[model samples]
Target: MPNWVDGHPAESLSIKDRGLAYGDGLFETIAVRAGRPPLLEYHMARLAEGCQRLGIPLDLQLMRTELLAFSAGLGEGVAKLMITRGEGLRGYAPPPVALPRRILQSSPFPVYPQVNGVEGVQLFPCVTRLAEQPLLAGLKHLNRLEQVLARNEWQGSEFAEGLMRDQSGRVIEGVFSNLFIVHEGALITADLSRCGVAGVMRAALLDSARAQGLKVEVRDIPFEDFLQADEVFLCNSLFGVWPVRSVTGHHWPVGPLTRKLQAIARDLLDI
Candidate 1:
């Protein structure tokens, strides 16, 4: 049982909601620590940017207050805030005047795996490839059938995360996280300009690494190139950074670079 709305009853979700019908909405999963989200501003910025791109009227002040108040006093948790085009009249056409609908829920932080969010994690290269949609590229939208299919490929018991490719078979990223590999002391990640979610942690690392004078490249990644990398790690808003111990039976070391990155990540988390 959780608060679906800030002050509304549970039945607030209409059967006619577009988000439920066509997944015409967006969501942000925030990591909370000590009654506060670590990167609240960055999360909000990504949310606002998604809303603006989707033509959804976003009451930034209202959203900020509702979610913040709801998340307060929860030392460790996850907050998912979503907005959908409310109650459309059975069609793809935008409503003359859209009434936005929302869902906000908080849950105790998930007990990530023993190796996950800790020592390191394994990855399974998924057969499911994300479709090319420039309009939706880099936005964390509600349409996640791709991720659903990818996640179902193999239970994370054998592998911590699934690696997804783009339509052209270019290594895109992990199903629910951003991908980064350290090669010759330089960090390389996929160029999300075409597809994949532009993760907040990914953005921060890009900025932080640049500030630290580390070379960061946003380029297309081939499977062979990725497998041959010196070091690799995956990141999300919640799991700050998790080094890849292996990928599809190929062993990888939790290198010195990954440890250095993890040190910064520890400061960004509840630990």
Candidate 2:
């Protein structure tokens, strides 16, 4: 169960819980190891930036303490830390003095068979297109109806994920993870400024690739490019990385670069 303080499980959210009523909140799905969530700096930076964008006041020290107390002794698993504008007026107007709500919950880590990434996975070309909202784009906020619909559009085992496009018909990303396509031995992924989640793992890969002397292209991806790409992979914080074996009738290989990146990611995550 999730609640606003450490160890106290409240029955219901405060009537003014902005996230439930207005989706006025942000969240992070972090990987916890030894009961401690790693990459705290990156997550905190996102939180601080999210608060600035949403006009919410953020107390980083307080949040740090709460997170530490909440995840204490949980061993290893996934943790979702959320912050919402507490109680507020009935309308969209925020309260003058907002009481922020902090909610934390833990779950068993999603186990991935080592072979899953080593070999490859499948994908479905989702019919749903991500509606671009420049102001709210890439924040990982609570308004996730687009992802919900895209995910619900698929019910096949052949593909473990759905690749989504934007309203402009440009490929954006996978439903939850980031999309990367290899072309001519180069790394390419969607530029997520207009839409899509800015995944933490995807960021790590970008930085790691640059460090390893690989050029990463961030640009608009068209549908036709997938048919010509050498390889594809979907990445997220929890799953780390997964190579795409096929999409629709198009097939791809788990290339050397994909495997090398996966190995680097696995070592980084210590999985």
Candidate 1: which pairs clash? none
lDDT of 2: 0.82
Window of ten residues with lowest summed lDDT in model 1: 1-10
True-vs-predicted CA distance for residue 152, candidate 1, Å = 0.7
lDDT of 1: 0.83
Model 1, residue 212: what's the lDDT? 84
* Model 1 lDDT at residue 237: 81
- What is residue 1's positional error in candidate 1, in angstroms? 5.2
Candidate 2 regions exceeding 4 Å error are 1-11, 113-115
Error of model 1, residue 185, in angstroms: 0.8
Q: What is the lDDT of residue 53 in candidate 2?
A: 89
The per-model lDDT (C-alpha) reads: 0.83, 0.82
TM-score of each: 0.94, 0.93
Q: Candidate 1 lDDT, tens digit per residue, 16-41?
A: 88999999889989888877888888
Candidate 2 lDDT tens digits, 241-269? 89999878889988988887887778667
